[model samples]
Target: MEAKELEAEILRLVREMAPHLLDLLGVGPITAAQVLVSWSHPGRFRSEAAFASFAGVSPIPASSGLTNRHRINRSGYRQLNRALHTVTLIRTRLDPATKIYVARRMAEGKTSRDAQRCLKRTICRQIFKILEPPNRTRAASLTDHANQLDAI
Candidate 1:
């Protein structure tokens, strides 16, 4: 297939895979697809923290006596990290929420790079939430239905 044709087909598949994620501000088709591919089965991750760890966004302990700092994690899915970075960069420029967050972090003595890292971490959490399966357990749904039958 021609490069342009292949690109178009991939974009189409990405849209079909996660239109809601694609609809999110700052998430392009590629970014949406990356998120979907990295988290094809969200149930594998028990929680957002697990997702963050999988993406290498969870903060690793770096405290040393009185001094404390977290180090940049150079592990996990690099493509996923890149996707989150892309979303963070776009949001820093366009999304009001991210702008406010970055500005607040900057005001609190964080450099733009640090603030962006923090924002990317935040994006990881959001991605996990978007990708994670609904919290309404099957038992809860059945219980609710049983209660409705009792009332009836």
Candidate 2:
């Protein structure tokens, strides 16, 4: 298939899999697909922090002297990281909320790079929440159904 056709197919697949993810600011079909590929399954990540770590968006301590600072993590799944970076770039340029967040971070003394890192971390958390499996276990669902039967 042609590139445009392939992108269209991806869009269709993404819509079927997780249409809600596309609602997030700056998340296009390509980026959403990358996320799904990296995530692989609902329970792949134990927590948002784990997903952030996988994406290399979790900050690593790089404190020096009395500075008490962190640095951008330079390792993890590079393709996922690149996908996140692309979303971050698009948001920074076009998303009003992201622009305000970055400005606020800058006003608080963080460098532009630092602000972007923070945004990426936030985005990672957001994506994790959207993609994570529902917390209700099978037993919980069964219990709920039992309760409903009793009520009926």
Candidate 3:
């Protein structure tokens, strides 16, 4: 299928499963699907470290005798980083808690870029949680049913 066609299908499925979530967020399923597809590549990152690396949020450590410094990791999916940064900015603007969190980070001496990175990491984790299959929970229930059958 074409890109637009696939996106439409994803939107349709999302609408079926979560009509209210989309409505509450003021976004159609197409927009949500686009964001999910941007972050949902399989075999991409196995751990948070890998995800942070891929998102360009992981800090690079630099140290010498009696001196140490950390720099932002810039080598990663620039598109993914841009997407996450954009989401962070939008979330901070719309979510009061996120705005306060950003302010607190700044008060703690974090630069604007550093605070944005922190926001991006939080957004990335939320995206990860949303994309994971709900079937995993149902699978656990199915396993319990099988155990009951064995007990019988």
Model 1 scores what on Cα lDDT?
A: 0.78
Give me candidate 2's TM-score against the actual structure: 0.86
Q: 126 in model 2: Cα distance from truth in Å?
A: 0.9
Residue by residue across 1-152, what tens digits does model 3's lDDT show? 59888878877877765454354232446556545455554333455667777778777776688856456678887777776666676677787888898999899877887788777777666655555433345456556767889999
lDDT (CA) per prediction: 0.78, 0.89, 0.66
Q: Which candidate is the best by lDDT?
A: 2
Per-residue CA lDDT of model 1 for 36-85, tens digit only, reads 88887535666787778888777777779996667666787999988888
| Residue pairs whose backbone atoms clash in candidate 1 | none
- Which candidate do you rate higher for lDDT, 2 or 3? 2
- lDDT per residue for candidate 2 within 32-148, as digits (tens), equals 999999998665666788889999989999988888888899999999999999999999999898899999999999999899889999999889878875684546656776788
Ranking by lDDT: 2, 1, 3
Q: Candidate 3 lDDT (Cα, whole model)?
A: 0.66
